[model samples]
Target: MNGDWLLRGRDGRLSVYLPSGDAVLCRAELGPGGPWEASPRKVGGDQKLRPGPAVGQGADGYAHLVSWRPTKPGEAGLVHSTHFRPRLAALDWVPIGHPDKSGDRTGAPAVAVDGEGRAHVFVRNKGGGLSMVAQKEKGGWEPWRDLKGSDVQEDLAAVTGESGRVELYAAVPGGLLYWRQGEPGKPPVLEEAVETPVRPGTLRALATSADRTTLFYTDDSGDLCAWRPGGKPVALLASAGPGPVSAVRCELDGHDCTLLAQRSSSGRVAFAAYPTEQEAAGAWWAESGPQLPSDARVSLATDEDGRVVAATLSPSTGQLLLTRRKDEPGLALEAWREG
Candidate 1:
C-alpha cells in the first residue's frame, strides 16, 4: 500500500491530506469542481474553547462543523463522569456575531445543501438549546437561528431531489430528524420526532442508500438496524464483541447487505463482517465472519458490488493491515495471511 488517500472529486483532482498522517477531521467535496480539505480557519474568540467535532461535507457536497466556546468563564472544573449532568458550557461559540463580536463555534454540527444551492450548517445553542447557522449561496454565512434540541451529534445526511424537494437528516439524542423544503429559500418544515429507545449519541453508525429506500444505523448492542419508514427496524446481529464498537463499514452487495466491524484489544488486531438481506430473517449472521486477530482493528470503507475494504490496525506497530474479498480465489477475496 502506498499509504496515500485522495478524495476523488467530479473534477478528478486530488488534494493531499493536510500535514499528512491519519486525518482526525475530513469532509468530501461532493459533486463537480471536486472536494477540498484545508486548515480550519481560526474563529477568533475565547482561548478556553476547544474543537468539538470536525465538519463533514455531505456525501452530496455541503460541509458541516462545530466548535465549543464557553460563556461561564475559567477552565472546566467538572469531570468526564459528570459530563451528562449540568451540561457544562465552558465557552460560548457564536458563529455569527454583531460583526463586532468574538467567540468560537458551538454545539453539535450538521451540514446539508438546499435546492437553492445553499449550505445549511447546524449547531446546538447552549442558551437556546438547538441553534444552527446556514451558509446562504456558498457565500459567508447566515445569522444563528434557534434549532430545537437539548443536545445533538455530528452525523447527518441530505438529499437535493427533484422539484426542490430537499431533505435533511440529523441524529439527535431523541431520534432521527427530517427537515424538508417544498418551496425555495426557506426553513424546512420540521417534523415531529419518531420514538426510539436508543439515543442519538449512542448510535454507532448511520447510512442511507442512494435512493433513500434503505436507511440504517447501529446501536450500542452492535446490532445493525434499519427501516425505510413504514417498516420495522430489523436487527442485523448481536455485535462482534462487547463495549463500544466502531470503525464500521458497510454496503449493499447483490441481494445481500454486508457490514464489517473491528475489535481492538491489547496487542493483536481483529476484524469481522455481517451479512443480511430482506429475504433473510431467521438466517444466521455471526456465522458469516472469520476468527480475527488478537488485538485491535478498524474498518476503512467498502467498494461497489457489495465488497468491503478494511484496514486492520496493527496492535504493536499500528500498521493498517488491509483486506478485501475477491470473487474466484480462496478466502472470499478478503483473507489475510501474514507470511
Candidate 2:
C-alpha cells in the first residue's frame, strides 16, 4: 500500500499504513464513510515488519511505529543496511513486540508513547549513536539504550493531561531537547527543547489540543507556533517565505491544519490559514481560498474537517489537491488534478 499519512479519523474512519515490510504494518479501516464510501480494513498486518519513518498514538489508544526499510526497495540501497537488527514495534488494534534488541543504523526511526503507557523509541544509530528505547511496565524493551543527551533530534508529543506525560521533542543542530514523560521506568526528564531561533526557522509540525493543554507547532520559515510553558511560541502566518510544506494536521476537532505547496522563496504559491488553539477572545486569522498548483510538491490535501484539496500527481505533469466540504466531490475528475 506504500502509505504516507493517508489519514481520516473523526469517525468516518480511514487509515493507511503500508510502506511494504522491512516492517510496514499496513492497517486499514474505512467503515463509516469517506476515502471512497469506505471498505478497507487490513486491520494490522506486519509479518515481522521493518520499515522506519515515524508513527505515534497516545492518550492510551495505543498504536506506535517508525518505518524504514531499504536494504533493497527501489535502489535507496543499503547493502549492509546500517548493519540491520533494529525492529522496535508496539502496535495497536493489536501488536506489541518488545524484548529489546536493536542496533539502529540511522534510517530515520522516531516513535512515541509516554505519560505512562510506556514505549518511547528513538534512533539515529549507524554507529553515530542516538539510540533509545523504553517500555517497561508490561516489562521488556530497554536495551539498545545510549542517548548521552547532546544533539539528539527526536519528535513525539501527545501530552494530553500528562498522566505519564508523552512529549519527546528534540532538536540538536544548535540544541533543544525535552523528553518529558512522567511515569515509565523512572527516567525521561530532560529539558531544552523549546525551539525558534537560528533563522530559516524550523519547528515544522506538532499538534495536541483536544484538551492536551494547547501545543500547536509549525515553523520552517512560515511561522506558526503556540506552546504551554511560560507562554511564548506564537507567530502564526508567513514570517519568512518559501513553500512546499503540505503536511501538518491535527483536526478531528483539536484544530490546527497546515498544508502548503511550493512556489515561494520568491516564486509564488502562498496559501494561508492558521489557528490551532489561540482563540479564546479574538480568534480571527482566517484563510481558505485557492492556492496550490505552481509546481505542487505532493498537491496539498486534507480531510476530516480541514477539508481542502488540490491534486495531480502525474497527469502530463501532475499537481494534485482534494477537499470536499460536503459538496461530495471526489473521483470522476478528468483534470484540476489527480493521477
Candidate 2 TM-score versus the reference: 0.28
Each model's lDDT: 0.39, 0.40
Model 1: residue 44 alpha-carbon error in angstroms: 14
How far out, in Å, is residue 7 in model 1? 5.6
Q: Where does candidate 2 have its weakest 10-residue lDDT segment?
A: 77-86
Task: Give the local distance difference test score of model 2.
Answer: 0.40
After superposition, candidate 1 runs with Cα above 4 Å error: 1-49, 58-106, 113-118, 127-129, 149-177, 181-186, 204-223, 230-232, 241-253, 256-307, 312-321, 327-339
Tell me the TM-score of each prediction against the true structure.
0.54, 0.28
How would you encode candidate 1's per-residue C-alpha lDDT over 1-339 as one tens digit per residue? 111122222233222111112112222223222222233212222334343333332344222333343445532210010011111121223343311133333334444445554655544444424444565665666765665644445554444443444455556664665555647666655554554434343233323343333334556455655544445567655444432233323443443443434352333333444443351544232222334455433434443343454444433343334455566432254454320
Which runs in model 2 stand beyond 4 Å of their true positions? Answer: 1-37, 45-131, 134-142, 146-155, 158-167, 170-232, 235-339
Report lDDT (Cα) of residue 275, candidate 2.
49
